[model samples]
Target: MQKEGQKSSKYDFEFKGGKNNSYVFETNYDITYEVKFKPSSYLFDERYQFSSQVFEMVIAVTESKNLDDKIPPDGLIMFTIAEIVTDFFKNRERIIVYICDTADARHLARARKFGLWFEKFKTTQFMKVDASITDEMGVIYMNALILHRENPYFVEIIDAFRKVTGGYSEDK
Candidate 1:
């Protein structure tokens, strides 16, 4: 793993925090979440208690330790996996879920039916992704919550993240 202040080049980063950050295992999912930040994602850390993962460089919130039910959604940053789940459960009407990936139709259909549980999200599209790590294989996804946010409060999460990580340039 790269050390502190190591120049950001082309390295695959997975989303993880808290004690789980110590892990190095990979997931079998296809979607890649491009979590944008203000700068080089430097402010967010384990304190937020968010557990995340990535297909390539894009990070996704898989779990959280600290969660608030009433908070409005911004762009979702610096939060725990618990918070994301709580927010989703609390406001199912306003949130839309998206499960993105580069898996084939058979894999995708199986995942959708056996793995994902959805309450919102009117449509889902599966696309092919080009990841530098493995073969040119990956998935890029765009998902918006059902609730429209005139002012995204969670965007701050991304801002802080870019600051801490030192460089936040991610691929689409």
Candidate 2:
């Protein structure tokens, strides 16, 4: 946890750049995580005629050889994520889409935890919007889009997302 008045980055674990726009970091618990930003503009291109930059942010546990149980809460994990996001926004304007994994049937819980992390660590220059949809199979998918507040196509991007998600509401 960060002390009062301390920057969030101060608590971030050291992370290194990985192949294909991925960031790799290891937690104090010895769990390795890989955060990747995969090109995903195809998701919006055909439907919305959109031509801007968009990536699907995927975070996964890359190596957990020593772990045999569920991972515990680690504040540094959120800090590391925040740092990677900050780095991603430094160069250009882009949209990051995060869809929680539903394989374990805990996607809602994952989404809630992600929401808490974003709410606690997001900077003033950042903005996030969330949406949820139920597929024909009755599986619910929760997703979030994060972007710089100064993005040129901010309004259009949000609109495209809303249209794709069946006009789902935004988060305040």
Candidate 3:
């Protein structure tokens, strides 16, 4: 929307490769993600109450038209998402990642696997995140991953997810 080189002070990140940048959204089908979260966990039970501050980011993988072709054999998207998570941890940012991608089912499954990989990281304070994967439409799915500094119980939820998914538990 900002037309490549134009920078908006209102946004948190500027596109590195202009409009052609893989992260910039072209069609609604492109790789897009939204994050909504709150600073406090007291309203965990009341979902409708804590839906105030939401942050969104787009991650459109380039060089490929279909989902399977876009994902590298070495799992580059997972690695990049991991880096983003680490940056949030270092900055002490509490957020929920809503990944919406028009990729294949395998890619969405991979995202879930990658979310489980977050269990290996432990910050100074008890940090936990429960990543949920759900269907949005055909070839499109949403992964809602929540990170909290105060709740260590998130680790258990992630572990349970990993076990349920059965992909990340293969000892990679």
- TM-score each candidate: 0.20, 0.86, 0.39
lDDT of each: 0.28, 0.79, 0.40
Prediction 1 TM-score vs. true: 0.20
Residue pairs that clash (backbone atoms under 3 angstroms), model 3: none
TM-score top scorer: 2
For candidate 3, lDDT tens digit of each residue in 1-172? 2233554422233234332222222222234332212233322333433322223334444434446544334323344445454544443334444454544546666566645555544445533333343445444444544445553444444454354333232211
lDDT of 2 at 28: 63
Candidate with the greatest lDDT versus the true structure: 2
Between candidates 1 and 2, the TM-score winner: 2
Per-residue lDDT of model 1, residues 1-172, tens digit only: 2333544322234433333222121112222223311121122344442212111122333443244432233221222222333333342222222233444334344334312322222222211111111233454322212222321423443344345334343211
Model 2 has an lDDT value of 0.79
Off by over 4 Å in 3: 1-52, 56-58, 64-70, 75-77, 89-93, 100-103, 122-142, 150-172
Worst 10 residues of 3 by lDDT: 20-29
Q: Which residue runs does candidate 2 get wrong by more than 4 Å? A: 1-19, 46-52
lDDT tens per residue, model 2, 39-150: 7877696554344478889989988766786887877788788888888888557789999999999999999999999989866788889998899999999999888888
RMSD of 1: 18.2
Predictions: Cα RMSD each:
18.2, 3.9, 10.2
Clash count, one per candidate: 30, 0, 0
